[model samples]
Target: MKIVKAQDFDLRREVEYGSPEQNEAVRKIVADIKKEGDAALLRYTEKFDGMKLEAASLRVTQEELHAAYEQVEPSFVEAISAAADNIRAFHMKQKRNSWMDLQPDGSLLGQVIRPLHRVGVYVPGGKAAYPSSVLMNVIPAQVAGVPEIVMVTPPATGGKAGIDPYILVAAAEAGVNEIYRVGGAQAIAALAYGTESIAPVDKICGPGNIYVALAKREVFGAVDIDSIAGPSEIAVLADDSADPVYVAADLLSQAEHDEMASAILVTPSEQFAKACQAEVQRQLAELPRRDIAGASIEQYGAVILVGTIEEGIEVINRLAPEHFELIVDNPMGYLASIRNAGAIFLGPYSSEPVGDYFAGPNHIIPTNGTARFSSPVEVDDFIKKSSLIYYSKEALLSNGDTIMELARREGLEGHARAIEVRLLKEGKAGANDDNK
Candidate 1:
């Protein structure tokens, strides 16, 4: 890694990421699926996922789920179950209550909070089996009191047969009501517009490939979508006291995620920066995905040598990273200063995977620079709130004259007369007063 003066490193431009062409492809698929329905979905699924299944078999049955449990290791299933407990417990804190307040006048006003009737969570299976993702996406919906949650993954083919058994086991633990072995744009379309088999969902959550994101965009008006997630990212702000090895390892953790993934390190210590550079090289030699990590680092990574720790923090704030790790001394002191970040990991012990797995915080974080405005997946995503208002007869009577005056001022005679008629019926107004 080459050390760069802070001025030479660009932060604003680096934040903008994702493929525009992919967005276009998603639009086309969504439009066709809307017009052609299941037939269009089948064509896309077969073309993209290389699986051709009848629409009837899209849903995974209990028998298939049992087989999945049998296939996965018992220890893996148990671990997922344990993680589910933590995820559910954490999200339960985010649960909202329906509230109403009765006025002194005979009127009640408040908000009603209700869970979405149904939701669909997409799990990416084209590259890897994200059992962790299954847990993260499903647990929050369940905690939010969503009645039905469905999961979809690209169908396993050849010797591969279905959604990963580990993913299935996690889904089972996370309270997912149904699992579908379908993937890509087609899956998004199927969830948006009900097919012969798949029920239309009120909302769709979870991360996916570019095609999946495009499909979600196309279906926006028809169904709510959590967000169009981009490639993963991590930014580490450290000082001389921060361990170079730890910094290098954390940077590599995100770099290995994808070629487009970004791993940035900002430090005030030139000596520490060089040490981290060396440490990254030493560790990269042993990493399983070194090629991917190396490419990501070469293309998207940066090591900025700032003149001061405050500058490092400023750079991080400007980046608004998806994952922000503070490996500096007094990490907590700077927590409030960080206004933008999908998740913050303080101290070396709090590794990225901690939040990704056992920690109750949702791992579905904002990607690219979206953390500047968006937030991580939480129970709030599955619930909606409506405001309420009411007025008593006495309250209406007291305000009726002013209300009619405003309505008549607006030239809405009908509106004014409506209130006048009510007042007359209650004998509150003179019948001959014909202002009615």
Candidate 2:
């Protein structure tokens, strides 16, 4: 890992917008799916996923869901169920009811909160199966009362014949039944524009490869997408009191995610920074994904030297990392200073994986410095809010002139006239009265 002064370090990573070829390819796939529907869907599925199937086999069967349990261990099921409960409980607190506020003027103004009618969660199904991701994406939608939660994965995982049993088990545990055996950009297209078999969804969520991300971007206006997530990131702000071993391990936790993942340590003490860098080297050699982690550490990982803990925090806020760990003498004291981070892990014991797997917060976090403005996937992502406006005759009559003035200022005569027509008809009955 490179050790650089705070002033010397450039924290921004070059955003991946996909190559021109990839973008053109995605556009073609999306357009074909839109034009051809099921025939196009199946043809692309076979061409990409190498699975030849009819439209009848598009949806996963109930027997497949039940049989998935048999493939997974009883212990695995127990653990996932517990994790699901934790996730569901945490999100349940985020649930909000549709409310109306009644004013003295007999006006009803508020928000009508309602869950999306249907949502599609795209689960990546290649070398690794993200059962935890299935839980993270599906549970929140369930908590938000999304009636139909559809899941789409590649027909095969790790070049195998069927979807990962663990992913299927996780989906079942999270209360999702509608699933399909498809993947890549085509799957995103299918979700956005309905096929003969798969119905269109209100939104799409979950992680995928470059193709999937680009597809989500292409189909965005047609259906809402959670986010076009970037590579994983973790920034650790530590003091001399922090353990080098713990700090190195936590940093590597994110680095091992991929070659593009970023892991950085911001500290004031040069001695501690050197210690953590050496520890990261030692841990990286022992990791199963050492090559991937090593690349990430070589390119993106760093130990940033700062003048003080406050300066380190300033660097952190500038980075706006996806995951942040504060390992200091008093982590709580610094919590208020942290203005940007998708998920925060305070102290030594609170590792990032705790939130990623079981601690209840969604791991589908905004990435690539997006935490500065966006947030991690929450219950709100699966729900929509419609503003409630019930202006009484008196309320409209009292406010119509102000509304018209604002509208006219914006040169919207039609908008002003719409309110003018109402006031002209109703203003005859004591328009000057303060109360109805």
Candidate 3:
């Protein structure tokens, strides 16, 4: 990691997000799936993942789900259950109810909240196991009363023909009834447009690699997506009272995610900056994913020196990191100063992994500075709201002219005419000359 002055660094330096070729490839994949359906799904599975399958065999069977339990230890089942309980409890607090208000003029105004009928959740598989994500994606939808949650993962793992048992176990524990053995851009397309075996979904959630991200962007209108997520990131705000070891460990946690992942430390003390740079080097030597983390640190990681803690916060807000840690003298006092982070961790004990695995908060967060506008996945992502309105005769008689007047100001004759027709039917208001 390089050390630099805050004024000398550009916080929004462009990282390796994706390429045009990848976007074109994803577009073609989505088009093929939309047109060819199951046939295209099978072809892409064999081409990208080397997994051959029949149309009937795409969905995981009850036997497979049961055997997934046997493959894992009893302790894993207990842990998943506990994590699921925590996640469920946290999201239950975000649940909403459909409500209607009775007006004085006998009008009914309301917002009807209904959980989506079916949703598709993408979990990255094919030699990667992140069962925690399964819980994060499904729990909020379940709390919002969604009836069906379909999960998709890569068909093969380490040259084998099955997903990781832990992923299957997590899904089963989370009450996911439907599971499909497809992945990548093809899987996203299949979910959006629906293959013969898989039905179409209202939305897609969870995270994936570059190809999956591009595919979601391509299919956004066809099917709603959680968010177009980018690489994981962390920005830690520290002072002279901060611990260098803890700061370095937290930074490496995100750096190991990808070469494009950014890990930054903003501090007021130059001594702490140098100490953290050296600590990151010492810790990187022992990490299993050292090569990837080293590349990330060399390319994107930095220790920036600011004049004061307030200046450090300004730098942090400009970057708008996916994760922010305030390892300062009084962490809670600085909480309100943070304006643009996907998640906030205060003090030394609240490590990034606590939110990633347990602690009841959804780990799926906005990346690539999108936290400035977007938010983490919650019950709202799995549901839709329909605004309800009922206009009484008395209400229309009192308000029709004002509505027509506003519509005529916007030059929307058709809108004004519709209101005029209603007013005429109710014998409330006069007709406009254009309509006559």
Q: Estimate each model's TM-score.
A: 0.92, 0.95, 0.96
Which regions of candidate 2 are displaced past 4 Å?
408-413, 423-436
RMSD of each candidate relative to the true structure:
2.7, 2.9, 1.8
- Give model 2's TM-score versus the native structure: 0.95
Model 3, 370-434: lDDT tens digits are: 88888899999888999999988888888888888888988898888888888888766564555
Q: 1 or 2: which has the higher TM-score?
A: 2
Candidate that would win on lDDT: 2
C-alpha RMSD of candidate 3:
1.8
Model 3 weakest 10-residue run by lDDT: 427-436
Cα error, candidate 2, residue 345 (Å): 0.5
Highest-TM-score candidate: 3
Name model 1 segments beyond 4 Å from true.
14-24, 157-159, 401-421, 427-436
Q: 1-436, model 2: which lDDT tens digit per residue?
A: 9999998998778899999999999999999999999999999989998889999999999999999998989999999999999999999999999998999999999999999999999999754689999999998988999999999999997356588899999989988899999999999999999989999999999999999999999999999999999999999999999999999999999998889899999999999999999999999999999999999999999999999999999999999999999999889998999999999999999988899899998899989999999998999999999999998988888888777777777878788778777877864443322321
- Candidate 1 has an lDDT of 0.84
Worst 10 residues of 1 by lDDT: 10-19
| Whole-model lDDT values for every prediction | 0.84, 0.92, 0.90
Question: Global CA lDDT of candidate 3, please?
Answer: 0.90
lDDT of 1 by residue, 175-264 (tens): 675877778887899899977768899999988877787788778989999998888899999988888988999999989988889899
lDDT score of residue 14 within candidate 2? 86
